[model samples]
Structures are given as structure tokens and as C-alpha cells.
Target: MNAALLIGLSLQLSSCSNDFLEEETYGEVKPSEMTQAANVERAIISAYSVLNGQIDGASNAFNSPDSNWSFGDVTSDDCYKGGGGTGDQNNIHQMEIFNANSTTIDIVRKWMALYEGVKRSNEAMRLLNASTDFDPALKLKRAAELRFLRGHYYFELKKIYNRIPYIDETANTVADYAKSNTIFTSEELWGKIEDDFKLAYTDLPEIQTDKGRPTKIAAKAYLVKCYVFEKKWQLAYDASTEIMSSSYGLLSDFQQVFLPENDNNKEIIFAVQHSINDGQASSYNGSIGDRLTAPGGPFYAQYGFHRPSKNLVNAFKTNSVGLPQEDNIDVLNSDKVDPRLDITVGRPGIPYKDLGVLYSTTWARDLATYGEFAPKKRIVSAKSPFYVTVWPYVNALNYYIIRYAEVILWRAEASVEINKLEEARALVNQIRQRASNSTYVKTLDGTANAGNYNISTYTLPWTNSIEATAAVHTETRLELAMEGHRFFNLVRWGEVDSVMKTYLAVEKTRRTHLTNAFFTKGKNEYFPIPQSYIDGFAPGIITQNSGY
Candidate 1:
């Protein structure tokens, strides 16, 4: 499908409520009529559409906040749940403090959205299998697409709640879905997800005619991610190596990768497709989760949430030779910093965007609580011609799920795990080289150089595997800062406990809200399974995770 048609279909599918899952028929078309190829294709489109369910208004409001922003960023040390105040979105504040419970609304909402995705994908698989009208080749391709999406949904669930029910096409009824725990062991569940992605990797073409659809390379990249999560280092290394040999490459400039004009660039392996003013009355098709992250007041009329932390801002500071001064906060006032900082964050006195206005402290809603920096990567300039005022805060920017740089970084990580230090350094340098090209942020009249903007490749060779691993981890945090992967990355490295505890200790001294924050190693690693799911299941059928 073309981008325009996909946008229209996205809006149409999003309009269906949770009731759509229970309904025997879709509109006037009965389940019997769904045997036609066209209807089956629509079913497939609906499955693909569910991938955007994490966006605000795409699903129920209880889960309206994207977990990427909540669980991924705010829960980590990178961001604060910046809204009206401490009382605003207290559930999120609970998350920031490692105090969220099973009944937390965000947890319930994220669970529902991910399972809804699983259900839709399963429905597509059943429809495709029952339909006789589709060409055999097309059927195989579309089936692969459905399985890829299924694997993607399961992957999200797996990361959030380590143990979950595995439902597929055969488990069509609610009763069947309720028996989730009995069906597979946790290891078996990971194997099942891997099976789907392996099928997708084997069946999907290297490239797709549709811009948003996953390619074979995209499936391979995700498989590498899954292996990394499972700690299957050799498998991750093999899969990442295959992806590195693909046609994808880094965009020369880091800032351009997220711009509206470069939405589906070569750098992106898979992205959640978004379009503005595609006849949706609200911001359903736009990047709505990011609406609150834009500068407040005159900069852009919106709520200011997901404020970047001073710690994150400090992470950009580089020494004389362009290596990160991880512990030297005193050097921040005088040190050269990575150019990507300007691209990722909006600090005081910096150019906010293409707009001439300098980012001021007033742009932050609560300077005393959240730090001074505003998020910039996904924020569209209100002054730009591409800016859509119909939804004012939302825009036609695609949210990248996997990019080539990430693939390189994953390979680098895998290399370090397997003691391939030289290979890891080369991969990390590939990303830094591209970041080095992102030298300046443009102002209305002229461009201003980002703080120092003197990033360079690692000059010193890795002394050992552990040193190389730490370098790869730091590089991942800096390169993928606010894109919502920090907490998960730290967790996968088994560093979240130590890292977050130290982070909170120092951060409390800076931001008073974090004075009581604490991170327990085992208990805080994953979120509690939503209480509603447990209540819905038969007694003793759904066991909650360790802490909650």
C-alpha cells in the first residue's frame, strides 16, 4: 500500500474501540464474508494498524501515555514526568520512584494495547488462512507480515512483564487467552516469539513496496534485539552481522534522521508510520505522545512533559580529545560536548528549533521540579511549513522502532560480549562519525555551533572486553538518548540497579523530587502484571511477578 492509503487505513482501524475485539462482525460485513481476499487484506491492514495503539487516542485513555515515554524514559534517570506538578500524573511519579503497583493505570493500559495487537495479528492470520481468493505468493507474504507483528507485540510484552500468556490464531476465544500461563514455560515463550520472527526473516522480502511494512532486514534486526534481551550473545552476533551486511546505512547528519522530510530514510529499518491532517478529527495519526514534550508558552502551545534531565544533558560533555567525561560535572561549563546534544535536547539559551526564539527557563512548566531542558528530537517546529496546526501539537513524524545505527550498536555490543573488542570499537566509531557530521543547530537567521561539537572516534584501543562493553553501553545511551530505549538497555545489561541507584542519589541533590527515589535490584527490574488481567483470569491461573 502507498503511504496515503496506509494513513487512511490507520485512521479507519483506530476508530474501532475495544468492543471491536468482542464483536462477531465488523460493520455490516459478517465473519463469513471475510473469506474474500479484499476483506482479508483489510484484516491484515487492521493488524498492522494496531502497532500504533501505544500512541495517545489510538487506544483507551487509561493507557494513553506511551510506555516508551513512561516506562522507557521517565522510569529511567534520563527524564522526569514533567506536567503541571507532583500531583499531576502521580501514577507516572510512582513509576519514577519504583513504587508502581499492579493496579497502576499505565501498566493496565500498556498490557491491553500490546495484547490487542496480538489479537489483531492473530485475527489476520486466521482470516488469511481461511481466504481462498488470495494468490499463494501474496498469502505467504501477508502471513509473514502478520507473524512479524505478532512477534513484535509479544516482544514488547516480554520486556515489560517477563512472563505473559502466549496466544496465537488457535487461541481465538477469551477463555483460551485466559489459559496463558499453562500453555508455555517462559523459555518456551521466548522460543515461540523467535519462531515467528524467524519465519518473518525467512519469508519477508529484503524491501517492501509499502513504506511502513517490515523488510527481511527489519525482521533480522528485531531478531538480534530479541537475542540480546535473552542474553544469547552468539545468536545476537550472527543476526546483527547479517543485518550489517544489508543495504541500510546511517544518515550523514543525526538531526535529519528525525525530521518530517526524512521520515522513511535509509537509516530506518522499521518505524510506526504517522501522518497529520489525513482526515482524522483528532491527533490519532500524528505523534501525539510527544505533544506534551514541546516547549510551552510562545515556543509551542502545549503541556510540557518528559523534560530531559541535567544528567542526560551532562552526558553530552566531552573532554579535550572528544571522549565523554562521565563523572566530571565541573567540566560541563567549559568542555566541548557531543553535537547530538543539541539535536536531542533543548537547553537554556540554545536555539529551540528552526524558530528564532532562544529556549528560556520559562519554557519549562516547573523549573524547580523538572530540569531546564525540553525534548527536541521528535518536536516539530511550530514555525515550519510542515507543521500541522489542525492538531497543533502532533505532527507527521515517524517514530523509529529500529534504525541502522541501532543495528550497528547492537553488533558492537555483541562483539564486546564475545571478546571482539576491535570489531566493537569500529561499530561504535561508525555511529560517532555520523554524529560528528551533526555539527550545528539552525536558527531563524543563521546557524549556531552546538557546544563544542568536537566528537571524535575512540582514540584509545580497548584494554579488555569489560572496558569495550562499557564503552558500547555509554555510546548506546548517548546515541539513542530520548528515543525511549535507555531503561530497557540498562536492564538488559543488568546494570539498572547499580546505575539507577547511583543516578537517583546524585539526582536527588539536583532535583528535590527524587530525594525519596529508590531502585531495588530484582523487584524493580520489571513492572507488575496488571491486576485487571489477574482478576479476569480464573483463580490461580495468572500469577503476578515477584514484587507486586
Candidate 2:
């Protein structure tokens, strides 16, 4: 009922705790009572809680992780699906290889989790709209927050499944739920999603006391992302301009930005707040989806999933005076590269964090299959109070969905598309300059720099839009690597076909699993709709994607 209790509710929602729903109850607050302010806040918390992608009955929440690790990272050239073996979580491996079909379990489960968030958000909005007992002004703000959440869930659904149903607060009945995925055109769906965020921008406050609540700035940033995905360059730039004028800016230290202690720092506009040992049963409040992402080094749990690829490792290579070498023939260890590489990945012989233990090949779980590199950014220090060393090794580190730096790059991208090449270059230079200023990771003895760090910002002019565009895209890949944005970035830019072709060509030689790998651009651009859900409804409720 109080603020503190509401914060706890946001961290862990009891409404979503059941492993299996009993026949007698739906395990939800009664819709009639949801009109009360106390219940409204609780309902809102329930919606926010699902953003972490922790479904109790779902065996592996990683299938539906809000972070999009499987769909975004493994699907891209950035990572390999490293786990127990080839057969382990094979649904994801199917996605990794672009061999997935409609029945793929990962696709189904991700669809379910995203739709669940949409349902919870819709329920909150319905209650807020129906409530006369609540303060009118506060009710509007709360509804805007729920709408923003709805926009996010819909955004994820739209990205993965392009022709999804646009269900809203009014669709309460069983028959209403049967609305066709084709009810609206793809453009219309984008408009509806934009409408939600636009409303949230108008109503939500500039600041919120709740750690994970969407402020006006957060809504505006999401707008920029939506525009960028839609390729509406002018709209994206205008929104990003407002965000730039705001107080949000980069943190001085790049390495410190990802640490748990800086979870909700100024640099991060929005993130899914993970809480360990919270009141939730079974510690599901922690990093359920990301638990497997921990690289199996000493002072860290040993799952060794989400291994960084050699292609990604080589991508860090820089020429003399700190410029990127786009397909450089440089060995990983001996080459000079960006300092951010050491912070983002754990290679053999580099000190893993500040734990005083050097990362070794022994830490790698299937080194022959996945290579020696492991994911470093997602894993927190074992000594951190937020870490849980239990079976799944869940932690309390928040996954950033939108950071200020991301918006800057998005703005840079928009500027280039609008022929503002010089503007885009300046924006990208901001990101590179920060990377140059950030501290380099140290060796095990703390006496020397880890790897050959020599990253710096561009001093030369981006002569044309093509060059500027390439620079921005490359910077985006380097700046946001391993954060589950790579594949989507390739998709939005229409470069997946060429990029993946080049990646698979070389990667097949390195790893045998990729020997037969290929990406069919049109067919692979978006995943097919889950067949089971379509079957649950009428014959024409949901149409499959082309070539499915």
C-alpha cells in the first residue's frame, strides 16, 4: 500500500509466481477491484515485472528473454549458441542456424511471454480508464505509463513477428481476443504503437521516483527507437534532439556503466531492473534469462553460454592511431584494439573483472565448439552482494534496453539518412571519444593494460552519406556489442544478407556447425508466426510469414 511496498511489488510480482495455474483461479487480481488506486499500482507493478521475461512454468526463460539474446545475438554474427552441447536448448540453436520453423519452441515461448506483457499492460490500462475513485490527474499519468509499457511489448512483438494482432485495452472479451493478426496493415500497426508512446510522452512526468518507471525522457527515447526502426529519419532526429537537450548524458567511465552499482545511472534511460533474493519464490526476481549467460571462469558461475564469436573479437582490431580495421588480418591477442573489447568480452589470459583471477581456457565449457571467449558484460562480480550462486546463478544486474549513448547513435543514424553527414560524424565522435577516455582493463597482476588498447575518435571528415552511414553503423556495433542489438541492427539497415553471407563464409571455416549455414534474406528477415497459437483460433486468424 505504501511506496516501499510498491517498489518491492515492482521487483517481484506474486501474481506471476505460479508454476501451474489451478482450475479454480486464474492467479490474478479480480478485474472489478482493479479500479482501486492500491490495486491499480499493484497491477501496474505486475506489468512492469514481466519485462524481465521470467515465466515461472517456462523451463527456460532465456527462450523469451526481454534482452533478445537468442534472437538478437546468436542470430547475428556476433555470437555462438554455446551451452552443454549442440543438442542442448536446440530450439535456440535452430534459430542460431536460421533453421527454425513455425513450431520452434523458442519462437512460441517468446511470443507467449511478450503477449503476456501486453495482456498485463492492457489490464492495467482498462482499470485506470474505468476508475473514478482515483485522482483524475494521477489516473491519466498511470494510464500513460501502462500505455508506454503496452507500446514496448507491442514493439518487441512487431520486431520478431511482423504481422501481429494489435490488441488494446478495449479487447476484453474472448471473441475480441480472436481478432486477426491481419486486422491492420503493418504500417497501421506501427502507427498504433507510435500512438501509445506519443501519448505517454504527453502525459508521463519528466521524472519518476520509482526506479524502473518510464519517465518522459524514456518515452521520448523509445519514440526515437521506433522512428529509427521505421526509417522515419526526420521524426527520429527531432525526438532525439529533445533528448539531447535534456540532462541525460554519458557516464565518465564506460566500464563502470555496466556494473550493478550503476544500474539506474543517468546514462541508462530505461532498463529491466533485476533484484536478487527479493521476496519472490525461487529467486525468480533475479536474472532468470541471463543466468546462463555467465562465462564459466573462476570467481564466476560456470554455465558458459552466449560465447562471443571470433568474428566479434576480430572486429575490435584497430590500425595505428586508433581507427577500425574493417576485415583486418590481425590475431586477437597481438592486435591493437578498442578498450571496450576487454570490458565486453572475457578472453583467455585476461583478468576477469577485478576478481584477481585470470581468465583461462579451463573456464570455457565446450572450448572446441564455442571457442575460448565468453560473455563478460552480463556477468557481475561474484563478490557483489546482488549475485546469487545457486543452481542457475541468477544475479541482480539490470539489463539496459535504452541508454543515452544509444539515442545519440540513433540520432547520428537519422542525421546521415537526412544528409546531415557532418552532424552524424560529430555524434559518432562523441561515442568514440568516451570509449577512448574510459579506463583499459588491467592484467592479472594489475601492472599492465589488458590487450593492446589504442582506441580513439575519428579526426577525419566523413566525405559522403555512405561513409558517414558506415561509420555510424560500425560504431553502433562496437559500442553496443553483446547487448542483444546486433541482429536487429543488421535487419533494420537491410545489410543482413550481405553481412551474414560474409560472416558465414569465414565462420564456416572456423566452426564446423556453420559449414552448411546460410541466410535467405527475404525468408529470414522475420520469423514465422507460432503455428500453435494460430491453430488455437479460427482458420484465418493468423497468417504465416512468406515462405513459411
Candidate 3:
């Protein structure tokens, strides 16, 4: 295809169309027409565009349309589907109660968006391989990028739905995707994803000229994450060691990592890039999805969703030495807490960004149903330059997929598994120390510290590997709270059933919405594959996950 036509196709892919599994052919520009190097480059850009799935409008509900927030945070113990009530986004409410079925809209939407991403990546590889005229070196680099993206989409699919159709560049028609056993075994699927990342790691450059593009280091980090998920301790450690040797390191201030000015900084290994006032019909380039998570009042009026849960807030409680008070809830109100809690959550008396007063309970739309807390990580201040008045509540802040602190924690986990407890403690300490330095959130008058912030690193030796591993997991939860990693971490560590069941029992007393919540061990681990995928195509071919 010519460059303009290729760009047009990319725009079509990014539209809010719901037709996902169907193949829409652009007038076939044969291999001969795409001989120019620029056309090949445009084709690669088209593949990247699919990363931001369909943007329907400037609605906060679909801001990160393909994100895991609904499943990763709301379904876990960290958050609630904060809105008008259980009737608001009722499908998400079903998911929160562990009752979401295959026909649920959220499941269908997420499934289609991810499959569309897979299709676009496959198309890009097919077009790139067809062209015989582009520079061989450039072709290799583009191929590696596409492979990384394909692996990423599949990884998301594998996590959400254990059995998914693996469509590569060779699957050219709907029939191919409809074939029986298109769903490979779990081991085979992970292997496919691992191979793709390995290729990207070997071929990608150390850095990229553009800010949003992935690098060899990013690929290495992703590979480590893959190994960590599979419990392959030695492989995870080796890959993490390589990433730590790179130029990236933790940002000195933990709060700065989320601010708009510090986007794509040394701390972030890879993130979804966002831009404000891009002149698109909708401000879809910004992170409008999280706009509702901000406190609503005369200051910032918006939909209030994804409110932080009371259980998550309580987990931040720290003791005199700055370690978690795991068994004591009575100590929370009076004892010192982790400094990162003030940065991650908005409580009744903490300052609400640069907008002057302390966040009040009145900010929540229905405090009786959800809670008195708000999410603060992805929110932007009204006075910040990243704030765009055109899309009043929307701000162009990037969402991190992986950061350096996460890499440190992953390395720590791997070390504990490999019997290197001291190394693991040191890695966890690095994250805690940075959080301790991030204790700048104060009262509106700036005269007193917010919520008695206090955090200290692990100084005593771990008694055993189990204790060391538990410490690493708790640190991970504190460091990466509300960033859509909680449920996934729980699942990988085999702690979801116990952790969530207890969470529901305790939280039901505070928030009545979760009174009926229960998490089954085997079935609740992955969401049901959408029923539309089974009924619409290949009736008996696509099997459903258990207890759907």
C-alpha cells in the first residue's frame, strides 16, 4: 500500500468499531506496490496505532478502553467500581461479585479489543515480510517491534482467558482463526509468547530515537516478567540482572514518576504515551478513563469511579519501625503509615493535588456505597500544563506498563526463590527508601505532614526464604498499588483465593456492596472467554473455561 493509504488503514483500525474477529481487507496492494521504504515504515506505524484500542469519544468510562482496571483492581481487594451504584456499569458490578458470565459486555469488549490488536500486529508482519525492496536492517528492526507487540497482546489474552486462539502472520482468513484446537495448551501458548520476546530482545536496539518506542532493555524487562509469571526463578533472575545493568534506575521521588512532566523518564521502561489537544474529534489521546477517579466537587466535577477500597487503605498501616502491621487494624488510626499511601490514595484530610483544600468525604458522589477515599496516581492537577481545558477533565499522562522499581522487586522475588535472601532484602529496600523520600504530600497550609507519613527499609535479616518472599510480595503491593497489578500478582503467587475471600469478609461490613462476593479457587483465576466468540464463529470448536 502507499503511505497515505497505509495511514488511513491505521486510522480505521483505531476507530470504535466493534467488529473484531472479522477480517476487513483494504484493497489488496500487492507486494509490488509496497516496495518503497516509506510505505513499509507507515505500515509499522499502523501496527503501533492499534495499541490504543478503539477511541469512541472523550468519555471517562472508556479512557483506557482495553485496560485491566475493571478486572485487575475492582475484582481484587484494592478498589470498587465507584459510580452512582451497582446499576452503574452493571457488568463491572457482576465482575466485582465473581458473577460475570461470557455474555457480559466488559468481557466482550476486552476480548475484541485485544484480538484486534493481535490482528493488526499480524497484518503488519505479513506486509513487512512481503516487501522485498526495503533496507534489510530496517526490516529486521520493524519485525522485532511487531513481534513484541504481538507477544504483549497474547500475554494479556492468556492472563484473562487461559485458552485463546493463536493467530500469527500466516493466519490470513477468519476460517483459520475458527479452526478447532486453535487454542493451544497453556504451556505451548506461554512458549510462543516467550519466543517472541526473545527475538525482540536479541534484535531490538539499546534505545530508540522516538520516546514511545520500545528498546532492547524494555524487551528484557518483559522477558523477566514472563519468567516470573511462570515461576522460572533462574531465568527471571538472569533477565532481571541484565535489565538492572542498563542505564535505567528508579526516580529519586516516587510521586514524580506519575506526573505529566516526568513522563518517559529514566524510571519508566515502557508506557502507553498520551497527548493532549491532538485535534482529534475526541480527546482520546489523553487518559480520560481515569478522570472519574478524581474527587468531584466545585473544584473538579467529573464521574467518580474506581474508588480505592478501605482494605487497601488499611494495608498501608505501618508500625514504629515502618514495617506493615499485618495483624492489627486498631493501630492504623494512631500509628505511622507507609509514605507511599499518601501519594497513592486521597483520604478525608490529605491535600488533593495543587487544588487547595484537604480532600473531604463530600467529594465522593455516594460515600455510603463505595468509600471515603479516591485514587490519586493517574490524576492530574487542574493547574498543570498537561491539563487541557478543551477536554475539561482529560489529561495527557502516560500509563506505565513496566518501571525500574518493578524490575527491582521482580529481581528480589527471583532472588528469594533462588535462596538469595540478602540480595532480595536489598532490592526491596531500594524501593522502600525511594518511597520514604516521597513524603512531601502535606496539609493545605503546608505546615504539617500528611497522615503521619513514615517508611523505613528492611534492616533485619530475613529468618527464612518464605518470610523473604512474603516481604517482597507485600512491598510489591505497596509500591505498585492501584496501577492494575494487584489481581495479577495475587494470581501468580497462588494467594488470590485466601486473600480475596478474607478481604470480602472484612470489607462487607464497611461497604455493603461486597456482601455477596466470593472467589472460587480454580474458576475465578481467569475470566470466562466471551460467549460471542463461541456462538458467532466455530460453534463447538472454541471451548469455554471451567465454571463460566
Best candidate per TM-score, number? 2
lDDT (Cα, 0-100) at 407 in candidate 1: 85
* Ordered list by lDDT, greatest first: 2, 1, 3
Q: Candidate 1 versus the native: TM-score?
A: 0.93
Q: Which residue pairs of candidate 2 clash?
A: none
- Report RMSD (Å) for each prediction in the order shown: 4.9, 4.9, 4.4
- Best of the two (2, 3) by lDDT: 2
lDDT of 1 by residue, 38-152 (tens): 7787777777655655423442332443328778999897889888777787888898889899998888777777776777687778878988889999898989988898999
Clashing pairs in 3: 63-289
Candidate 2 accuracy as TM-score: 0.94
Q: Scored by CA lDDT, what does every candidate get?
A: 0.77, 0.82, 0.77
TM-score between model 3 and native: 0.92
- Evaluated at residue 506, the lDDT of candidate 1 is 88
- Quickly count the clashes in candidate 2: 0
| Residue 517 displacement (Å), model 1 | 1.5
Quote the positional error of residue 94 for candidate 3 in Å: 0.7
What candidate 2 gets wrong by more than 4 Å, as runs, is 1-32, 328-330
